[model samples]
Target: MDAVGLSLMNEAVGGSEKCVSAVREAFGAAEALMIRNVSQVAKDFRCCQTPKDHQDQVELMQSLADIVMGTVQYNEESVLMSISDLCGVMTNQSAAYNEEREPYQRLVKLSQIYRSSSEEPCLDVSHEKRVKDLMDTTVQSERRAERQWTYQTCTEFGFYQTCEDASCPFSGMVTLRSQTEICLELFGISQNSLPGRVAFTNRYYGGDEPHAHRVLYVNGGVDPWKELSVGNRTDGGEEAESVFIRDSAHCADMSRGRVTDRRSLKNARQEIEKHVESWLKTAQQEKKRTE
Candidate 1:
């Protein structure tokens, strides 16, 4: 490797090692041990897939660790508790996404261990910052989508629920997604909306095409975003499959059970678990091959 490349590798691994050490000390031995194992499993494939250069990845994660450690209230409690809360959300989040089982059961285990033993901890600065960031992102995304929809309507002459073309499939089902915008426009109360979809275009988990392995794309039949999904666009390859949950809304499988949840939702999650296990086996086989 070139000197620059070596430096990048050193930085990334160094930052990651520091983070692992800090977390191990903070979360306790058993949980920490699990973290280490999961870390190992993750390292088998996770960071390698990122398109971001190693320097950027290292610096970002290092900054994240610095912020987390700085804001953490107590080493023994807060971080784990916060993580447990996140895991609890994940358990319920599956149903929303048409997911059934926990797969590895990591979140379930974390929830049990922390919820039973710990008190409700106050949000540390790190938690507050993360939550606020998410809220901001969500609001920004909604604004962008609304603006884009409006622009598309005006430019492409897309109907906002009007059945001008009687044969159009979207005529009846597609309502004004933005009630607030409709109310504003109808009342002649002009509110400043974002100009375009730049914000939405930028907000992402990662890229598409080659880097997305072990990625399960689950969507609901009723989901507006179904057209943009893997299942909608193409037949799934070995590592990527997008399954649709019938009669479910967005991410319905990711959340906890509701009495209202459809039986099809349950079946959808079973399919998700099957995909996840397949991914795990793939990862293990690849690891063995490398070793």
Candidate 2:
């Protein structure tokens, strides 16, 4: 998900000239990705690919705007009026994206067109330009909020949300509120600049969907984020494997060992070492072949 690129946009607006170019390109890439995501789901997200109908698209965008605004503090409605307007721009961009995908998906061709104005294509270049510009604006605004949360309150904010949903040892709105005040004192930002609580809470939450064949997923049962992690539904097999330590802290296996380390942590680390060595063996064989 290009998390590094996303984090680089933390300066929000009026950053240094270097950040301006780097963030611009990074956001441009993300805007393309968002378009691809919406395209995969379509305007209504029903997995339909019919691009001719766009009346309902505007409403879908309004719903997204609602989701985006729901994360901010309530009193900032005045400032949100302008931010909400970017939803329309996103809608237009999504719609324009359809023009470049007729007969068959020419996403690559259209992407090239988006990258360079001089590239010739079988679609409206001017419309493509407009979509690109609007996407730039839309991405910049969303990323500004993301950057604020990333640099300021990401970890505690996520755990705080987990506490709100379930009992968490590190969870408490009091900490969040207190930290918000501290953030304001330390940095000139406010809670309003952070991404919505929903987005924040789901930051590390993922489904049990299958991943790479050799990938190893380690989860600690007591880990607050363990409530959501890859499943250990199957017995050991050739594909993906998950090692879950019910009593261990999150990511405890990755930490350097200590005599006081819990049994679960020790077991998890051994499993990790075994898997890593196996992967290295496979990689070395592949390298020998390539050589």
Candidate 1 wrongly placed segments (more than 4 Å):
1-211, 233-236
Per-structure clash totals for the candidates: 23, 1
Candidate 1 residue-wise lDDT, 47-108, digit = tens: 22221332323322322233222222121123343322332333434555244233234323
Q: Write the per-residue lDDT of candidate 2 for residues 135-232, one digit (tens) a residue.
A: 34355563455444544353334333311222221112223443343334434556665456435444544235543477787875434355556668
Error of 1 at 169 (Å): 13
Q: TM-scores across all candidates?
A: 0.32, 0.34
Off by over 4 Å in 2: 1-206, 233-236
Evaluated against the true structure, the overall lDDT of model 2 is 0.40
Residue 241, candidate 1: C-alpha displacement in angstroms:
1.4
